[model samples]
Target: MITGAQLRDAYISASNLIGNEKQKVDELNIFPVPDGDTGTNMSMTIASAAREVSRFEDGGIGQCASIAASALLRGARGNSGVILSLLFRGFAKGLKDVTEAGGQQLADALAIGVEAAYGAVMKPTEGTILTVARVAAEEGKSAAVKGASAVEVWEAMCEGAHRALAATPELLPVLKKAGVVDAGGKGLTLILEGMLSVFQKGIVIPSENVEEQQPEVSVKRAVAEWEGEITFTYCTEFIVGRGDQKAEEDAKNLRAYLESIGDCVVVVDDDEIIKVHVHTDGPGNALQEGLKYGQLLTVKIENMREQKRRAEEEAAAAKPEKQRLERAEPENDVGFVAVSAGEGINGLFRDLGCDQIVSGGQTMNPSTEDILEAVQAVPAKTVYVLPNNKNIIMAAEQSVELADRKVVVVPTRTIPQGLSAMLSFDPDRPQEENLLDMVRAAEHVSTGQVTFAARDSEYDGHRIKEGEIIALNNGKLTFSEKTPVKAVTKLAKTMIKKDSSFVTIIYGEGITDEEAEEARSVIASKAGDNVEVTMVNGGQPIYYFILSVE
Candidate 1:
């Protein structure tokens, strides 16, 4: 029998195990694009649930599973994360109201999870995580029917998962060509193996071993002549228990009060709690005002000036810096949210009518909650989302269910596609009409990308070397060159069709205006005088240039 506590322990062990092996799984990615985040996304998704589960001191097996399922859904990041969430959701459904589950019940739960996962995907692919899970569940069911113990059932499931994972290369030609099994399947097998370890060895893997290492902080004070005083000294955050108070009315009052005292105030209230974030000089006053609603569950106050000084010092020490984006209050009928990286690309999206821009693409994929937050910030009844990257589209779609506004995710696979889609938008037309027009516009445009190869590999008979500029024609690797200009020019020549008249080259962060112009001239020379070439400062990372031909 598996009790609630043991089940929780098993999941915790699984998260830690996956975290430890995440990089190994990441390296298995064969897709020529640099977005190798399946392992990280799945690990983070499960870790979110583990953190939530750890908070519950007392709960039945069903209650624990439900808590995990809810957290997984909300925290899901990429396609793998969403699929993992659906699997857990189905598992939770099977264990409803059960204090404990035995072998047969556990086996049935696994099957249910597999079914839910397969059902969720629009077109389920074989040899991926889905196949591995399905095979494991089927074997578990068989074992249970033969009157096996819970441990025996789990053992059978793990064996089946391993076998399925090994056979993935046979099912997917890409895997065979890459000389690797499915990354998602490998990740899933590691998770199941971790769970089996908990049941077999009575050991729970600790997260501390695989925890991310924090950079060393060295506070560098500025030269005495240019010191500035902080306007809002204190950063205040607290959560109020929603005891007998009406959440909506009290939340409104709380927001008003916080706004009066603070510069940056954000109050989010639910039936159970009222969470407050404010930047004010007087932290004591903010705490006093918060107490009027309910008892304060957690309180945190920090000196902003000190924090800022430390951050500056860290920047001076050569540490990477992260920019924080502020959320805007909702206020329009139709709004747009786009995902992209680089200041130039972000500015283009804003200028082209995107209300909110999420900073992510390629190597960095934003979570569903990140998109949902951006959606909520847009004060529109209907909001349109442009995911800009193919890998990010599924994550963006997951935000629709959680968003307060009607979210329509336009499947724009490239930044140029997103820009083209935005150009086709008509405010006067109905949403469905606009959707069709935007989708059509995106489809009509051909996209090409130039980026340095992260590793040396041969794909589709092309031998690519590390540090070489690689050209991708609509997500497929076409050619590799020693120079960006050669790659972009070659890519343009291939992308420009018989009727293609316009060519747009968006240069990234590494290229200067002169270099970009030279690249543009090279492209123009290759494309002939008939093609009208335009160059823009995209300033995006990873890719040296993004090309669009229509």
Candidate 2:
């Protein structure tokens, strides 16, 4: 039988092991795309659960598993992270109400976890983490049926996982072509091996290079000190769901009410929701006033003075830390949160009515927690989130469940699509109407990108050489050129249709203003003067220019 404490220790060991080997799994990425973050995503997802479990001094196996599953769901970052969370969610369900788990029970939990993972994915692909988990669970079930002990069952599961991971190359042609196994499978295998090591060898792997910590001040003392310096003690925030209420009027009234009681107030309203943030001594009065707007979501109250004191103490102890942004209640009806990189792009989104901009794109995908923080910061009833990248949509979607506000993801797969969606948004309309309009507008625009090929490869019959300028039309590699201007011109010609009227070119960091103008001139020469051409300094990395034709 495995105790809850033992299970927690095993999970910590697994997280540490995966962290140490994350780079190895990352390198196994077979996709030609430059961004490879499978290993990092999986590691962070499990690390979240490990941290949560460490806080529990005593609990049943079911209690501990549930805690881990909950944390994983909230912290899930990417596709791999979401899938891993689903697997653990099923495991927690299977272990529910059980204080201890035997070999047979553990095997059943693993099998359940695999089933949940497969069911959650729209199209379950083989030769990935799903296949590895399924095979390992089946092996564990077999070992349990043969009267194996808990440790023996776990050992068999690890062995099966390794075997499946090694065979992934044969199942996926892309993996074979890249001379690597599945990255997700490799990551899962490392986690299982680490867990097995704890049971079989009694070796607990410490987290990779973790520094020792110093703890001194108590929470009571911290709060007492905080009360002395700040006029307002409670930092309150909540989201109100719009239910047959006038968003604009209600938001204005709420802002007035909050301002009367507190400072640093922010009130944002939209067609479907209203978000409020304020620092006040009387949080109950604020909550009462918020109920008039709609049902409250994500009600949070913290002592700001306490947080400030903590930051000061950490700084005094020579520990460098980033300062937290001050929270203000929303004062608008509609709020927009956009994910973008580069100062120019951020400023553009801000100019286009975006309330908050999350700094992430391409190689660095923001986690679900990052998106959630951004969502909470926007004080509005209905908050629209533009992921602005295909890979980031899932992570952004996960924030909806965790947020207090009514978060509607606009599903913008590119920066151009995001900008077009913003342009189409009508603040006077309902959320449902705006959603359709924004999506339709984004769909009508054709996006193209020009970036240098990261590696030499043959893709779609095109011999792409490293450092060559490659033009991608609607995400497909269409052509390559020796120069960015030529590639942009060729890409623009291909993207421009008979009905296309406007061509917008957003130049990135590597290209100077002169180079951007030259590229725009080449595009205009090839595309004809009939099409209206515009240029903006995007200053983003990875791509030389992002083009949108509509």
Clashes of each: 2, 19
Please, what are the lDDT tens digits per residue for candidate 2 over residues 1-550? 7767667767777788888888887767644456637888898888888767755546788888899888888777677887788788898998998898888888999899999889867789999999999999999999999999989999889989999999998998877876788989888888888777766775656556453111111123211222112458888888998888774678889999999999768887788888888879999999999998889877888877677567547645775554543444666677999999988899889999998888888877777877888888888867899999887887788788787767899999999999999999998898899999999999998999998876667666677667788889988989888888788888898899878899999999889899999988888877776899999999998888999999
Q: How well is each residue in 1-550 modelled by candidate 1, as lDDT tens digits? A: 8777767767777888888889889878776557837899888888878767754545688888899888888778778888888888898999999898888988899899999889878899999999999999999999999999888999999999999999999999988988999988988898898788777776766555423311111112221111112347777889999788865689889889888887667888888899888879889999999999999999988776677666656544764544545555556779999999988889989998998888899888887878888887787888999999877787788888887779999999999999999999999999999999999999998999999877678788887777788899998899888888778888888888878889999999788898899989888887888889998998899999999999
Q: What are the TM-scores, per candidate, against the unseen true structure?
A: 0.78, 0.76
Worst 10 residues of 2 by lDDT: 213-222
* lDDT, candidate 1, at 122: 84
* Candidate 2 lDDT score at position 389: 86
Scanning candidate 1 in windows of ten residues, the lowest lDDT window is 217-226
Query: For each candidate, what is the lDDT?
Result: 0.83, 0.81
Model 2 residue 406 CA deviation (Å) reads 1.7
